[model samples]
Target chain A: MIRTLAGLVIVLILGAVAAAVIPEMQMREELQGVGYSYASRGMDETGSSNLVTAVIVAYRGLDTLGEVVVLFCASTAVVLMLTLYPIGVKASEPSRIVAFTAKVLPAPIMLFGVYFIAHSHLSPGGGFPGGTVIASTFLLVMLGSSSVPDRNGRLPAIESLAGLSFGLLGFWGIMTAGQFLNNAFLGTGTPGSIISGGLIPLISIAIGAKVASEFSGVFKAFRNSGGEA
Target chain B: MTETLMTAIVLTLGGMMVAAGIAVLFVRDLLSAIIITGFVSLSASVMFLLMDAPDVAITEASIGAVLATMIFLWGRGKIGDDG
Candidate 1:
């Protein structure tokens, strides 16, 4: 009876809130009006065909940087936790099919990831998704193989270098353009060209490297901990 | 016409999300629950795509649906079978 009453109260509150907010919700037409204006301005300002990429890497770059830092911190915490309670046996050998697919898949995946990062300024993908795709390739490698050889601490070094480059690039922007992460340092070439969107593609590459290494590092740490691959 | 079609897709995906959420709550098996959670993330990604947010959709599908599930399954292996 009490549970039923509680459910009723929750439903009542949700209904009331929805009723209040529903009328105020903007329709698609209204949203498109605002979005179109932004898209027009964003295209000119960022000199990229992909407005979303411009928004993420050019207009709201500081926010993206903060987001990268957050992911870095989270990966760091995962590493720390694994270090504290290192447990789990090495992963057993995967099945033959898994092994075969793993061998066949990683190269293509890496290539696609690189393409995604490189073409982000002119396409649908960007650093974050591209990085994740690359990391997933690493994950596939770890899954298929019984033991992956240690890289003599290369992953963390890559991560650190990428992060440092990102920061330095931001500072370069500030020095050149009077705004942090500004794109004024490089010329905004033709809109759909590979070299277009000054500072965006560069930043995307840095972020892609940093994020990919960070995630791969996290997976490595977790694998090293007592859990199987 | 497009608006109506979009609304239909949104409702369908939203319903799927709700079903997945409920399944996650009631599923006894931890691994199954984690998979269901991935389904929820997948549905959410679809919703994001319907909303014209491809960047967010990609992020959601990769990190939320794929990576999070992989991590959860890994953790579950460490925790043993009962969980």
Candidate 2:
């Protein structure tokens, strides 16, 4: 078939292109620009074992704030759009297995999300993922059951509070340490302990709360109208 | 020995991901395409893990593979059979 041949040819070309370009995605031993500084001094500067956390949450914290704001804007836009032009199609009820799984899974999933947010500086995850994982729990419940979630409710307040917390934490850093999102003001603690990462975990928790609430709000908007948002 | 093994694994995963990506394009069923795209993302996550970036790997697996797939499937379901 033409589709098969076309796919093969496309794959061959893309594979070649990938072979050349994909190496860039790999971690280079000699990092460039501020990346080099982050790589060398991140742990020392922030006392965070995970250098990625140090860079994103400590050094380039302002950029991360911007990223969170971007997500906020997107969530806001999605909620507003769906609120105005709601989907008309009704969701098909999930299977019995899905409903049961939904009921049993949210608790453990929530715990896992919390662990990710809390241990992010010591481990591989951080706020964005931890929060999204929490949001998925709400999404699962919506998918499994016929219950209408509270769309216009207390979650927006939580979202607002979380967003404010991020800025407030930044201001606290500025007041105490003369830098935005400065981790050293609170003392970075130890390298690998749960409390070691200082402002990283706190900021991650704030981000997680904001993301979870926003996404849950979006999910609720979709569910409330009896359709996808 | 480990270097060789890692290289082989990377190539295999890369190939699998490309194949999945192509297959998604040609797949007739929307559900199958969505699942194939998730397969692509999962493979990329595994590749990320091999590349010594557990943070990227976790994000790719959780967001790119799981949540994106779920949202796509939900939207597709709502779009109905006519779509």
Candidate 3:
């Protein structure tokens, strides 16, 4: 243990020395010329205020679809883990004070989570962040009521359905527009509005649901482990 | 005006990451260490925003905060306190 600690200290000191000795790293390149033009074109054509969303869901739609698949695989692994282990433990009733706080907090948080998910297109929060918030709310529910059943099966069902819908949407894009996850068919409406970003908002909703379910599944597994031992 | 505000956000975000790293090093508890790592991930996301890479930021935040925390909890099954 002492050796490991000494090694970590040495590594940190060496890293600090190197950083002090070397010139600062310039990580970003200037977005000039056609790159800017293309981005501007995306903003104009997609009618979306969030350039990042336009780039991800429109310009690089295929990548986003693959990311969703990755998330699905991760969630599937978690489901398989819980199934194989089958930790059938439940939360013991906590102190009344703890239970009361948990009960009161979740409803307001759930409302906020839904609000964030819906307003994603128009605001700072998006599908993933909104989804995490929603997941935490579900966690609050598990903590509060203590009445919900083992959520392992429910998680898989929700995750699979959401993944399927997202995949089908991508496949539909290929069928209709000869490209994957193409929003061109849906018609990009007016810029800077919630309803204007062609299929982006719908896609965000799907992503939110998928992420929320997966996160909740992971939380459930952790809680089960705690309950057991 | 917007540019100045953005720069300030960048600085604040960077400072927060540094603070979190320092805190993680000082803390002895493994669970707290894992939790601080989550905060580090969040600060990184904010830095990503300042650098104008919101896509990378979003992914980093989600995977870093949510996914990494889950992985740490799972791995904790194998590790013990002060062992």
Winner on DockQ between 2 and 3 is 2
TM-score, candidate 1, chain B alone: 0.88
Q: lDDT tens digits, residues A120-196, model 1?
A: 98878889999999999999998988876345869988999998998999999888888888885687888998988
Which CAPRI level is candidate 1?
medium
- Ranked candidates, highest lDDT first: 1, 2, 3
True contacts kept of 1: 0.64
Clashes of 1: 3
Best by lDDT: 1
lDDT (0-100) at residue B14 of candidate 3? 79
Of candidates 3 and 1, the better by DockQ:
1
DockQ of candidate 3 relative to the true structure: 0.34
Off by over 4 Å in 1: A1-15, A28-37, A227-229, B1-5, B81-83
Show the lowest summed lDDT stretch of 10 residues, model 1 chain B: B74-83
Q: Return the top candidate by DockQ.
A: 1
**Separate DockQ for every predicted complex:** 0.71, 0.70, 0.34
lDDT of each: 0.86, 0.84, 0.75
- Give the CAPRI class of candidate 2: medium
